[model samples]
Target: MEERLQAVTTPVLLESSAAGFSPWGSILRAIPEAAGDVPALLALAVEAGETWPRPGEGRTSLLFELLASVAAIDVAAARVFEPHLDAIAILSQAARTDTADQPAAAGSAGGTSWGVFAAEAPGARLNARPEGAAAVLDGAKPWCSLAAGLDRAVVTAHTDDGGRAAFAVDLRHPGVRCEEPAWVARGLREIPSGTVHFDHVPALPLGGTGWYHSRPGFAWGGMGVAACWLGGAVGAARDFRAGLLAGADAGREPDQVALAALGEVDRILAAAMQYLARTATHIDDGSLAAAGQSTWSEAQRVRGTVAAAVERVLQLVLSNRGPGPLAFDERYAKRMADLGLYVRQHHGARDDAQLGRLTLKGDCPW
Candidate 1:
C-alpha cells in the first residue's frame, strides 16, 4: 500500500527537503502502525489536507489512488482522512474562498478535526431553519462519525421547503453536543459514529437545495469512497495470497482451490481498477457529457462494480483461508472486520436498483 500509493501521489506531495524528501512519505508509512489513534489519524488527516489536491481538479486519479492506498493500510485512518478531504472538495466546488474559520482542507490546530455527516434517518433529523441572514441547525443528526473529536463538519440537513441543504458548522460551538459514543461495532472502532445534537447551532449555508448532489463533484466524491472499498478488497485478497505463498514456502504443494480463488480475485481487482481509471478520465476531461453519459450514472457503475467485487473477494478469502487467520491473527482479523463493515457503505441492492433505473433510462452503456 505504501509503496504503490507513494509512487502514485509523489508528484503532488509537498517536498520538504532539498533531496526531495516528502513529509507525507513518513506520514503514509506511519499511519498503519498508528492503528486507531484518533490524535494520530487527525494529524495525518491535517497533513493530507495540506498536501492532496481536490479531485476533478486535474489529478483525480491521484486522489483515488491515494484513497485506495490509505484504506489499504488502515480503514480507520482512511475513515478520518476521506471525509476531511471530501469536505474541502465540497467547499471548493461551492466556489467560496475558505477563510480562517474554514481553514485549508485538513492542516489546522489540533482541535480542528473535520467530518462529513449527511446520513439521514427517520425522525432523527437535523434541520436548517431560516434565521435572518443565516441558518440554525436543530434536532438530531445520526451517524455523525467522530463528532466528539471533530471540531468542524460539512453536514447536510433538511430545509424548510422539504429539500436538503448542506452547511458547514463549527462543532465546537456551545449549542452543539455529541451524544455519548455508543458505538460497539468491532470494525472502525476508532471512529465513533452516533447521534449529535444541535440546539440552534449557527451554521453557514454551503449550497442551496439540490446544489450539493446536482454538482458534478458529487459523483466524484462517491467514486472516491468506492476507491476505499476497492482498496479494502485488495488488502484482503493480498493477505489470502500471502497465506497461499506461506504454505508453498514451507514445502507444501499449493492447493488448487486456493489458486483458483486467487485467480478470480485477480480478475475482479483488474476490472474494477480499469473502470475507476476510465471514469476518472471522464471526470477530468469533462467527457462524460460529451460521451453521452451522466457523471452520476458513471459513478454508479464504478461503485456497483467495485462493491460487488469486494463482496466476492471477501467470500473467496473467507472460504479458502479457513478460520486460522480470523482465529489467531489479530491484524488479519481486524482487516477483515474493518473491510466487512466499511464496504457496507455501498448500500447493496438499493444502489443496484438505482443503477438499474439509470440503465432503463438509457443512461448506461450496454
Candidate 2:
C-alpha cells in the first residue's frame, strides 16, 4: 500500500517542481475517475475528511493519497509545477519519528510542518507601482502551516501595476525569513505555524496575481486543508481507543465513558463524510460556487464538532484509563496537541465571520 502511494506521489512531485502549480487542485478533480489500483488513497482521503488526532502519521497518509490522486489525473499542475513531494514526505516523516523541539528557531523545526497545506492571504490589497514592488511586502498572512524549512512559497502580492499578482519565491532567497513570535498553541507542537516574511524577496510571477484568486480551482483548493485536518482526527481517535483498552483492560466491558466518547467520534465522522460527498457532487456538476459554499459551511461545522469530540475523548481516557497509557513514551500527548492545533486551522473566528456574511447576503454565487 505504501509503495503504491509512493509510486503515485514521486512522479507528480518531480513534475510539479519542474513546473509551478500546486498538485492538490488537480488531484482532487481526478480522485473519482482514477483507476482501481489503489484503495488506500480513497480510504486516507475519506478519513481526513473526518476528524481525529495523529498529526504526523495523519499528514503522511493524506499527503501520499493526495499525490496519488493527482497523478491519477495526469494534471498539468503535476506535469509542470516544480514538485515538492519529496520535501513534504521527508518533513512529515521526520516530524512523526522525532520529538517536537523545545520551540527553537522559527523555520528550522521539522514534523507536521511538511504534511500540512497552508495558504497566504488571497484577497489582500497590494500597491502597484514599478518602484513600489521592490520596497516591501505589506500584508498579513494568518495561516502558513509549513513556514519552517520552506524552500518556496506561492504568495499573492499587490504590485505597482494597480492589480494583484501571485508570485512563487524560493524561501532561501535574500529577503525571506520565518518568525516565531510566541502566542501559538495546540495539542501537537510539530506544526511550525508561523509567519513567512518576504521583505522584498525577489518574486517570480505565477500567472497574473489577481487571476490566481479569481480562478475556480484556487477557491476550491482551500477545501483541501479540511481533508488534512480530518485525517489527523482519525489517527487521534485510534490512539484514544488504544489508550482506552490499555487502561485497566476494560475489554468488552462496555465502559460508559469510553462508549460515549466513541459514539461522539463516530457521529462527527459520519457527518463529515456526508458533507464531503455532497461537496464532491458539487465539484462534479462544475458548480464551484456551490461547492465552495458547501465546503466552507461543512468545514466550519465539522471542525468544531471534531475538536470537541477529540477533547472529550482525551478527557475520558485520562480520567478513566489513567496515566499508564503515557508510560511507554508514546505520542499520545503530541497527538492530542497536534489535533487541537490543526482543528483550529478550520474553525476559527474568521470562519464565523465568513459564514455570517454568507448568511446575510443571499447573493452567494452558489
Candidate 3:
C-alpha cells in the first residue's frame, strides 16, 4: 500500500513515488498546501479538467479513487473539487440520456470549473420559461458554492411544465447576480456557499424534467461524495498514527488506550473502504439497483455508514491524541474541523429515518 492511497490510487496515478506520473500527480500533491486557498484550489481544479470518470462508466472505482485522494490531501480542496467533478458527471449523464437539444457540450469545455446548484432554500426558487429556441431563468437559487468564483454551473429550476430540470448557465452573464453569503462557518470558510439570483439569465437545457434525481448516476455520484468522506477519515486516522510515531521516535511508547483507539479506527476505516469498493463494483456492473433496491437507498446507506465512521474516528483521534495537536498543529486542526462539518452532508439521523422508511417499503439491502 502506498502512503497516499493505501492501494486505492495505484495503477492510476503512479506505482510508487519513483514510478511514472501524470499532471494530476502534481495537482493532487499541491492540494494539501492549498488548503484555505480557494482560488489556488480552483486553479488546480481547472488545470485538471475532466480527470474523473462519469458515474457508471465501469471505471467508477477509479473515479472514487480520485475523489478520495483529493479528500485525503485536504477536505477543503475536496469541497471545491468534488462538486466540480460531480457536475461533470451529471452533464455527461445528460449527454447519454437526453442529447437531442442539450447544450451540455458547454459543460465539457476545458479550463472551466462547474458547479451543480440544485439545493433549494426557503423563499428562493428559480423558474425557467421557454422563449423561442432558448430558455430564460429568473429568481433566486440558494446554496450555490463558488457561485462567483466558478466560470459556469448546472442550475436546476422549475420548468414551464411545473417540474424541475437542469440547465447549463454561464455565470458571467449580465443578468446573473450573487448575494453576499454572510459566511460564518469555520470549516470550509474559504468556500462560501451563497445564494445566486438570476434575472432573465439564458440557460441551456441539459435533461428532461426531474432527470437530475431520477438518474441512477445520481446515486453513483452521491457514493463518490461518500468516497471523499472515507478519505477525510483516512486523513484523521493518519493524524493518530503520526502522533503514535512521534511518541515512539522520542522513546515514549504508546499507552494501551492510544493503541486501542488506533485499532478501532483501523477497523472502522477498513470496513468503510470495503463497503465503498463493493458498492462501486455494483455500480459498474449494473447491479446497484438490483433486487428491487433503490439507488437512493443504497447511496444513503453509503453516506450513513461513512458518516458514522468519520464521527467515531474523529472522537478516537481526538481523545487518544489529546489537545496538543489541535492547539498547535494548524494542518491537523483544519483537517479534523473540515471533516467534522463535511460529513454532515450525510444528513445524520434524518437520513437514517428516511432509510428506515425505504426499508419499510421493501428496499433493505440485507
Best by lDDT: 1
lDDT of 1 by residue, 240-319 (tens): 87788888899976678778889999998888887887777778888888878788988888898898999999999999
Q: Which stretches of candidate 3 lie over 4 Å from their true place?
A: 1-24, 96-110
| TM-scores, one per candidate | 0.91, 0.56, 0.90
**Which portions of model 2 miss their true places by more than 4 Å?**
1-148, 161-164, 180-188, 207-209, 246-252, 287-329, 347-350, 363-366
Cα lDDT of candidate 2 equals 0.43
Estimate, for each residue in 13-74, the C-alpha lDDT of model 3 and write its tens digit.
11113243344466776775676788788777766544556678877776776777788878
Q: For each candidate, what is the lDDT?
A: 0.80, 0.43, 0.79
Give the Å shift of residue 266 in candidate 2. 1.6
Highest TM-score model number = 1
The TM-score of predicted model 2 comes to 0.56
* Candidate 2 structure quality by residue, lDDT tens digits, 286-310: 4535434544444445444445544
Query: What TM-score would candidate 1 get against the native?
Result: 0.91
Clashes of each: 0, 36, 0
